[model samples]
Target: MSAEVDRGNLRSRIGMGDVLVVMVGRVGEAALVTGECEGWNIARTVGRVSLAEAAPVNPEWLATWLNSSYARQWCLSRAKATTLQVTLNLAALRELPVPVPPLPQAREFLRLMAVMEEKAQVDADIVRTVPAVADAWFRAETAGGWLPTSRFGELVRIGGGSRMRPHPEGAQPGPAGYAGPSVPVVAPADILQSELAHLARTGTEQEAAADVPLCPPGSLLVAVREDGVRVVVNDVAVALGRGVLVLEPESEDDRYWLLHAIRCHAADLASTAQGAGGREISHRAFAAAAVPWPPVDVRARFAEVAGRLHRRARTAAEEVGTLAALREVLLDEFLAGGSRTSRGSSPAHGPSVRGEGVQESLFGMR
Candidate 1:
């Protein structure tokens, strides 16, 4: 502990450069810590203590400890909260503990986590490129103008989902009954919280008739619901906060184009929209929005280019999922002191398992 922190002291206070924090309640379903300016300040708020301090240990060691599944379980059991909900209070945050390794070992630990972080970064970099590529193909090549000057409603079509009676508790577990041609009924929570944006269509005939909205295969789904200060338009597993629009392209040729535009303008939409409880955008708002559509020939050119880029993005994403699993395996091998270490092999070069089963990508809407 240092000397008394002066309330009026600017240096002692954290705002600009301190980590952009993820409170305990918001971490899992919300996002992982989003970094503050220039990206050096990403951090999480844990209950009972600053995880960086409690172990009297290397911050890297602390990072690995906090990231472990076991630690998540422990945090779940005693997550800090008030009457409204559980939250990590700063005073409580200081109480957590970590395993202190020798300084040298701690250095190694940081090195390994850094590698994992880098792989994760690489995966993200690939995903970020998808939009730019899509834009070049759809907007610039096809429409001839790839500028933000066009509003989404003018460029794409947005639609509402079906409204069912306020769903009753324990009526059933999931998509019940025959869900015909439509995809399964996915919850707002699932879409808003997921890291992946693409969702496989699934459900029974009855479910289709009852709750699930029958969004055509090519149409992107939008949530009209409100959460906190914003409305959410969700795609690619990220929620466009309230008043954010979801575009379902008018034709197959236009789908990726709309997704690209919506992604490009998400923040701007959120900022410009206004409402009391949640930011509001009416159907009129969408119908009246304008876009920079060039000529029909250009639109056709963009479609071909974007389709190729999208396919590449999809393939890269598939590989990234495999890498994420590999990273996890490496984490386990190091933590358990794997048997292969005695065979003259590095622990970092853990054996890889070929992905055999059909598995869900962790990056999308549920």
Candidate 2:
């Protein structure tokens, strides 16, 4: 029930605890709202789904179960694809079934999931705070001295990768016939908020060598047309796809400062983008953008601080990835009836099961 009304229209409202299933654009996507969003109109494409309650049956437990791999697979299997997008209608979604585990078992699963979620949130907080700390450090240290400004082109070499041509024989040696180690090819997706550690690539060394030009480690990679200006340090040699731009600093010591500067001014850089099909910042425009050019000593100091923050952020991201993998494994084991305890053991350290006769029902309604 919503307290607020607009022009006598009863808005489709969802509150802090509502769980919504995306029915159209991103079919089968489920999100649990942790914040309140009252009097908000939900589009027809999204369905508000809930489970019916019986004694000792927790809603949070049911919602978590619905978002697990078991439910995701069921939803994916039933979704219908059209030319534009895939969709799962309300009727079809309602028919998807979930296992009715005993109440104690469901609660135990929720407890394990809660532990993972808590750790994820802590890691996420670290990832979010590190950049802001870097930004603040830059602002504070540069406030005393009036630094001279210079065009980005004067300080760095900016270039795009050559367009790749796929070969008939997959993963063969390069044009030079050099059969070295296979290099990871980077697309826009490889550039995360603060790092570029993942890449999409052909498995064969030959395929990687043929067309992709390698950008050396420490080069700053930027995604031009994306909504958020994503920039990251390339830790390894990588070939860039079309959507990416590589910025190589004249002095390697300036790399950390340059990365932080670009991140701080990402919105401004994104605004200068221009193109027809999709907006993109050209090499020329990107190079010509003005940047604060502080003294070498000041930049070095900032770089030292920024490097520490970057390392911490990287560690947090790795921890989050590890926890997510563990959570997935736990969910798989629980759903498969292979685990009687939350920690994957028998009655030793796990929660004791009770209320075996509890009734369970999964309800899908708008």
Candidate 3:
């Protein structure tokens, strides 16, 4: 598919200003084509729309409406469920409704949207970049294997989730008589999908967390997938599911150190996995794997240095949720014609980061 032979021959090729919609798999995902993808072509599963010369809609506005909850629900309802994935037929896609406001109103809405999207993208980049910096530091400081090493189990407490009360099929059951605030239920799927080093949210929440022993923030959550091991430092209190393993540090000083240490040993831990599909992490094998055990002073120093970066990452991660909720509210108002008189506002300030400067500060040799 990456071959150049298909470049000029394909009719599916998209140019700037074309709107794209995912017609299959993750149905309803939409985007406006920019110069970055000038000559690129979409697969059979993707639908491209080239507007007529006199059409009254802007590509960005149309793309935004297609990505909204209203449009997503509409597409999902009509998409055909297949064994491997859902498929959206061309007829259904053609029937998708788009709301068009006057050019002035559309431009104002786009102005506000661009601001929020820019802020969210910066935070997303931070979530991905900070961990790489920390991992680089971990590799550099322990490069020559100067520190003494020991079995991973000896360095931290290893445990799994407790058994929950049985519930009827298709229903979620909480601890009896416990009706209170909800906490995220940390599942293997959540661990697999987490892009940030720290998890601030999950798909499922339960009031039963009040009765379950919540894993405090800062504990490491680990899961094994067919590809390899996945790990993240949880930011909020979360109740563990049956498939995840928790690595609780013995002291605050060891928290970040243990995090990077386990990450470094991901491949080694992954080799221990065994299951029907070779996807389960073997607890016995993982505990027995060897890892570098640095001295107390070394760990404390690394923790002190890396802790700041991790905290910033966590802050940005939390802000993403708030921004997302606000975006949805504004999107709904625009859809309902409730924001006709509203003028677009500038983006709110987000957590400050000096992009490459932060990396240099973290990776600068000691």
For candidate 1, what is the TM-score? 0.58
Best by TM-score: 3
Candidate 1's error at 95, in angstroms? 5.4
- For candidate 3, the TM-score is 0.77
* lDDT (tens digit, per residue) of candidate 1 on 320-341: 7776566556555664555333
lDDT of 3 by residue, 1-366 (tens): 655645544667778888888877778888899999987767777877777655667678778877766678778889998865688876677766566567897899899999999999899889888888888888887998788988868878887775442221122556677667777788777788888878877766767535577898888889887667889988799888877888888887787887888777677678877877766667788788888878899888898878888888878877877887787678767655674223233212112221111110010010
Q: Estimate the TM-score for candidate 2.
A: 0.73
Candidate order by TM-score, highest to lowest? 3, 2, 1
Angstrom error of the Cα, residue 65, model 2: value is 2.7
User: 61-81, model 2: which lDDT tens digit per residue?
Assistant: 546655665566667668887
**Which parts of model 3 have CA positions greater than 4 angstroms off?**
2-12, 23-26, 41-45, 76-90, 161-171, 174-182, 206-214, 332-366
**Per-model CA lDDT versus the true structure:** 0.44, 0.65, 0.74
lDDT of 2 at 233: 77
**Residue-level error in angstroms, candidate 3, position 354:** 44
Point out where model 1 deviates above 4 Å.
1-21, 28-56, 80-86, 90-97, 100-109, 136-158, 162-209, 222-247, 261-278, 292-296, 315-320, 339-366
